[model samples]
Target: MAIFRKPGRSGQPKPTPEPTPGQVAEELAELVEELEEPTAGGPADGGPSRQVVEYEAEYRAERGRRRGATLVASIAKLIGAGSRSAAKGAAYGGRAMADQLMQAAPRIPVRNLATLRAQHPTAADADRLAALLITGASRASAALGAGVGAAAMLPVPPAMAVEIAAETLAVAAVEIKLIAELHEVYGVRAQGNVTQRASAYVAAWANRRGIDPTLLVKPAGLAAMALGAEVRQQVRKRLTRSTLRRLPSLIPLMVGAGIGATVNRRDTRKVGRQVRDDLRSRRPAAAAYWSAAAPALPGETAP
Candidate 1:
């Protein structure tokens, strides 16, 4: 696939060149302008420490405003982008999506866990950082969903499913980044080189849990090995199911933007909460450790 290739130079997964952090900063600036607001999340570099206390509030409030726009503006956005997308899309096939995930896995940005801790220096720092990444991912998926949702509304041949598949790959990048970074915050590192770690995190994201250490035990030349059909199959199944779950966004009714936005938001939040809980279950003292650092997260108000 275009995004991944065979390992280079005697057998190490050649690290994907990092997209300039400036690119992320610029895109985020535009997103904030388009929505007239803010949100937060993990680094594009894949570390778990970030400052997201403020953006979460804005995203939580965006649903109601988008609900009001569902009848006109949101629909307008979807249809307008269809023609351009149609030119690039192909006939959607199951294998197409599976291939996309395989390609996307290695591109997920993940920072070294030890480095992430050294940079932040506290357990609570990780939680606050994970919050930003989690919320940032939620917003990123919603934006992709909106565009795909829009493309689907147009009577553009088989382009709708094709567009959906493309955006599925994009959202997978965002979520995979979140999942891998979350592992750092919980102090459980997925073992391996670049592509190997991405594969393990892809499985965790699809399986919707903390990284299974057992999956990380591959030895010697295994780091450069391609992911087996079993891993690819699980990712394919998860992506297809997640895409189908967004169908409610197609309803031209009151639920329009609200449904997709709400579902994506709630679901990502659930993934964050669940994974954190599961990891904490393994290290019951994690929360207590962070709790001692700060009673509440920055910008996390009294509830």
Candidate 2:
């Protein structure tokens, strides 16, 4: 049977396409960068910058719309009024997530020692800056978790899968950035090109420690500088565990929101402390000996 065509209104703008994984990573990186720098003329209290608080509100609002739409469709499905396409779309895998993370890692910007010093001139010691970076990253991560958790009450199972992937990628990006910056703070910047250094940081993220240049396993030949296969496998395992840990945050009612935020904040702080301790142990002595010069801090200009 032939159906009649309906007339459409003119001058309506097209809706924006859903962002790809890479784009999301870039967005998160930009946000982290903004959060890193101290705001001009702001208070000296050392809390999250104005941007961080604003982003949390914006992030929650955006996620609310996405999840709300999905929840309605999900409810329809539970009532036998929707299709199974959503379940299929939610079949995202851990390997794919890891690959996306590896690709996105290099895109995240890490400031050098000179830049960090310039940006934070008041910071008298590496530990001071490290503490600020850790706090900012922790707040950002908590915001992400809370945004996803508060998205819906009794989130649909299929929708929860997608949310888990989004949260995992976002939280990972924030944590990876934290790890890289901590390396900068302690003067242990990884060697190699941008991609190579990022891969090293990703490895550190997987191991939950600072990058030890000597212990790094480089590939052979032309690809020798790239992230090795063994490390990729480790990243996959790490991401899977992280994803699983987020499962409890999908509990019915609004309880999940609090759990997600607290867990993310605590986990990020824990990682920051662990990496800091390792870097501190490997850090060179600041005092100069009579016969020799003390090594300069990472990114510090050598005398």
Candidate 3:
């Protein structure tokens, strides 16, 4: 398919350049913003508040449907490439996926305490906001999983791979954003440049725990430097496990839909609860949250 190729001077296909980190960050930020924000009328309008998170999830799923053909073509090309690289061993795919995830981790847009309070003025305390965030994220993750599973019914079975990949990244983005925001709510916000703090959250996501205050101050923490080999390996293993867990959702027909949604919701809630519990224990006194947590300024990022 033409979608799988780009013409070159000699009529050979050429690869497209990867997006810059800035571009990826912008894209992810926009996506999360859409998912997190309330409906146009807001809660004050007294409109039909059909689950806002579910509505947003369906929006993304609709977009995925429109791109279904492209997804199939892209996966076709990916599978072909995989066949050619079989000699390199199975670890290659895991490693490459991990690298893409790591590249993405540092770019997730995280709001600080100031932004959270401003956006959610009605929430009087950190715990209140944290509860809302966890519930919304869990529902969103379930919706995304259901959407992907439903897509499996399409004639293009191979496209399940692409669907799974997209779902993984999207769900990860949602959860990582949740973890970062929870930290903000609890007043244990990680200290660093945009990339550094984000990297710490990524580590937290992989580890299935909140950021350790001691680690953030330590020179050996993942936040102290760019993602190292060991950290990347940890991420790879975590992602590998995550991807495998979604494999059952590839079953044809609508059976996968129920399976996918259930698994995703359960996993997301588990992570949220784990991180929330950790943060609750470590959070500083309520009075210190505002003074200690700095606002995340516009266009802030690591060099």
Candidate 4:
């Protein structure tokens, strides 16, 4: 057996391999290591940043403010310009209409008109009646033509113009009838005495309000006559039991005059403001002079 040992090498088995100490230590270090850096183009804190969003919101707000300011300034300028133009147009139109009415006055019969005081005979009754007629007529005419011309300035449909014209004429007719009847009940004549009295009242009121009284008188008279007729009809219904049918005759005149005073006052103020603005725009350096001197002019502060 000892002699044959060297010859048994062919039956030997292979040994199993074991890990080295250095290899084991390297693996342990890798398992316990912390991340060294973030991935490319990724956020360091791992969430979306708000810098871009905040910047965009701020930019939008600033832009909106600028646009709003521009719009407001434009609107203000347009309104100011329109106001001046409207006032000039209204003045011209009023004068033209008054002249037309005056020319026609001579042909109108005056002696048969009724008076307003026959039914409500009180202090200053005649004056009160005249006041009512003037005021009411002025309001009616002005209202009827309020924005008609303004529409023409715009690019409106053709049909709208016809409609507006027809409506205005209808309203004017009604107002004239009312004024006539009110005068009739008061025993005032439509053509002469009542017209003169009403004109005087209107002139006085216009003087106080700084407007051209002449511009308002005739139109107002026409409107009063129209409204007076309607008022008379209504009074007829209410006064059936009493002796008040005559009351309708005066109501239109009295109401008209009162309304005229109010409208004149308001419109005068509006015109003055526009005039001031126009003057300022045209001559900024002369604004102070105009303000102090204009009111002292004949018709500026007459009323």
Over 1-303, each residue of candidate 3 has an lDDT whose tens digit, in order, gives: 245777899998787644454554454444444445444453557754557745865676555333332332333233332444333323335676676666777777777777776666666777787877776677667766776677678533544565576566657777888999898788777776677777788888888998867866554565544557767787778877887888777676977877877888899889999999988887463566664444334786311
Error of 4 at 89 (Å): 23
Candidate 1 residue-wise lDDT, 1-303, digit = tens: 124666988797776444333343233323322332233446765733455544555555454233222322222223232566456544444566667556646654565444444334443466666665566667655665554454344443445545455545555666677687777667666666777777777777778898765554563323543457777778878878776776666654334455666776677777877777677656522344433333334677422
Which ranking of candidates, highest TM-score first?
2, 3, 1, 4
For all candidates in order, the CA lDDT equals: 0.56, 0.67, 0.67, 0.30
The sequence of per-residue lDDT tens digits that candidate 2 reaches over residues 52-73 is 7667656654553343334323
Which residue runs of candidate 4 sit more than 4 Å off their true CA positions? 1-123, 147-153, 185-303
Q: List TM-score per model, in order.
A: 0.60, 0.71, 0.70, 0.23
lDDT: worst 10-residue window of model 2: 285-294
Candidate 3 lDDT score at position 184: 78
Off by over 4 Å in 1: 1-91, 113-125, 150-157, 217-226, 252-255, 283-303
Model 1 Cα displacement at 1 (Å)? 24
TM-score of 1: 0.60
What tens-digit string does per-residue lDDT give for candidate 4 at 1-303? 022333335775433223332332232122111111111232455644566545654554343223322222222222232345344422323233333233322222222222233222331433353344443333333332322322233343333323232222222222333333333323322232545444422322222221122323355654454335443343233222111111111123235323322333344334333322322233222224212322123444421
Candidate 2 overall Cα lDDT vs. reference? 0.67
Model 3 segments more than 4 A misplaced: 1-31, 35-92, 154-156, 218-220, 223-225, 290-303
Can you give the lDDT of residue 129 in candidate 1?
62
Worst 10 residues of 1 by lDDT: 68-77
Residue 221 CA displacement from its true place in model 1, Å: 9.6
Clash count of each predicted structure: 7, 2, 0, 45
lDDT measured at residue 62 in model 3 versus the true structure, 0 to 100 = 56
